[model samples]
Target: MIRIELDEAALGATRIAMSPLRDAFCAAHLQLPGRAPSWPYQEWAGHARAVWREDDRLRPLWELFTEGPPGVSDFLMPRPLGTPDVYEELDQLRATDPAFVRAQVAVCYPGMGEEPFLRPYLTDPQAACAALADAYAAWWEEAIAPCWPVMRRLVEDEVLLRARTFATEGVDALFGGLESRARWERPVLELTKYIDAEYAAGERRLVLVPLVFAEGCRLYSTDDPEVLAVSFQARGAAALRERTPGPADGGDRLGLLLGRGRAAVLRELAGPLTTAGLADRLGLAPSTVSEHLSLLAGAGVVTRHRVGRSVYYQLTDTGRSLLALLAGEGVLGTAAA
Candidate 1:
């Protein structure tokens, strides 16, 4: 069991952040033998399977992720403020200290440090770091970037809900309710882990990260003596299913008010979707969806963000309120609810 003893000063220093690459890395763990299946990752697994067949560059990363690497990954997840970024962390990995990299290489593979991919770390640490960075980028482009919007939205929503929990139920209840294995007593929070150890938080802060794809809660201490990071599985994991729009009916207020085509576009925009994705879902041309999206943006109903070459659309607050009202009145059929 791991027990983190936080003093009164450390209690006030607690913070929360979300990581994109961390979730992607953890998703790799699900591909290993004896790992439990999760419903939220089914779509990701399907995509990853298809990508793995086409890309061989990611084999090293997949091999490393399939087994234990206890003290090896601490550098990839540094403690900081606000949302932790994947690209930023990858940059940090590129700049890791050579001595530390050498040490972690031994820790990562132990008896297998002579492996071909890990051999560069023993000879030229800089070259090894660069290769690792390239591998991460390749994996991200193939398996992560395509579905990051959905994962990001889920992580953000979970954080907002936890913040509400901390506000309404007090910090004690919030910590106590975090995971089944975590217990919050007066000055210490204990986690049931395989290895038993104790860490004292004298003055440094504790950073809590909510992860969408973590197998379970894990802890990491930073080079800075002032912060510790705890990554726990984000709530609502099983609910992240495919959100396809239902069959449209013209005998409704939403359809009559916005017209059938625009109404369907708005409904599917309940979650983030690219113009091409929406066109594919609704059986309309990309130009037709783009025209509808432009109109919706002009009317303050949808907001768009460019991810790579594609623009993803999601409902604004006004759009959500409109949908909520429609759903409440049974005008959107059963799918909206």
Candidate 2:
């Protein structure tokens, strides 16, 4: 098992509320507007997935799965499956949990009027948002309030690092090979556009850019009765190697997964297609593509949609953020900072 040492020094370095990349991300995000323009169908699953991953609330679920239990499933997977998310499971697990909910809640820097991204939402600005807008941004904050800090501590490190690095690197060639190799396709401007759309719709969804990767982690399939039961746990970088590297470690072979075929898959559909379509185009099996989609979706890069019989995919708000990061928009901080 790996231990998390809460060093004040490390926290001090990471705790900056408004880092350099945040600014560049905003500017770069201004690029995407009216993407496909309210088409016959809404292929915005990418935006949805991206929003979920980037939010501050997810931190709790992550930390719990990592540091709190013998089997990570105690924090994530359900027993035979009641509900998919673990918000309910926590009530039972809270009593003896070493990394309780309270600590997880701390890492989240509240964005309501605190950060520039949220400043527009704090008041009656030029755009009058709808009630749905008001409901979204504040929901998860309340849900995981008990364990915000734990998640906060672990999240956004790699995300912020990549963001800053993108700023310094050439914007066009920012994310190394994430785009060309991973078929990562998002313009930073698109993210702001989505947020603006939500705000205009009166929906108050909070948008964050924290990148979540299942790399260095295992994938749970529908065939698996129990995910954590069979899966192994990796503690930080060390323990992860002992079992199987987490998706964050690139266990998913994310680079190879992102390729020209993925790009064509999206373009050929005229919108978005199911995982099977993507797989066929990539010259890989459907399951292989699904795995890639999961990683991409988790990283706030791809989008997902459930059609009548199948689920389709696309890029999201966070995907746009990464595009900007890759474009050298916000990579201004020191390498390690």
Best by TM-score: 1
Q: How many backbone collisions does model 1 have?
A: 1
| Over 4 Å off, model 2 | 1-130, 167-169, 177-208, 211-337
CA-only RMSD, every prediction: 7.7, 21.2
**What TM-score, computed on C-alpha atoms, does each candidate reach?**
0.66, 0.20
* Tens-digit lDDT string for candidate 1 (189-294): 8878776878876856788778877663354555545677777877545434454554466446678788778888887764566776666556678899999999
**Top lDDT: which candidate number?**
1
Cα lDDT of all candidates, in order? 0.68, 0.31
Error of 1 at 133 (Å): 2.2
After TM-score superposition, the amount by which residue 47's alpha carbon in candidate 2 deviates from its true location, in angstroms, is 23
Q: Across residues 82-129, which tens digit of lDDT does each residue of candidate 2 receive?
A: 222333333333332323222222222232234433233234222212
Q: Clashing residue pairs in candidate 1, if any?
A: 204-226
Q: Which ten residues in a row have the lowest lDDT in candidate 2?
A: 232-241
lDDT of 1 at 101: 69
Counting clashing residue pairs in each candidate, in order, gives 1, 50
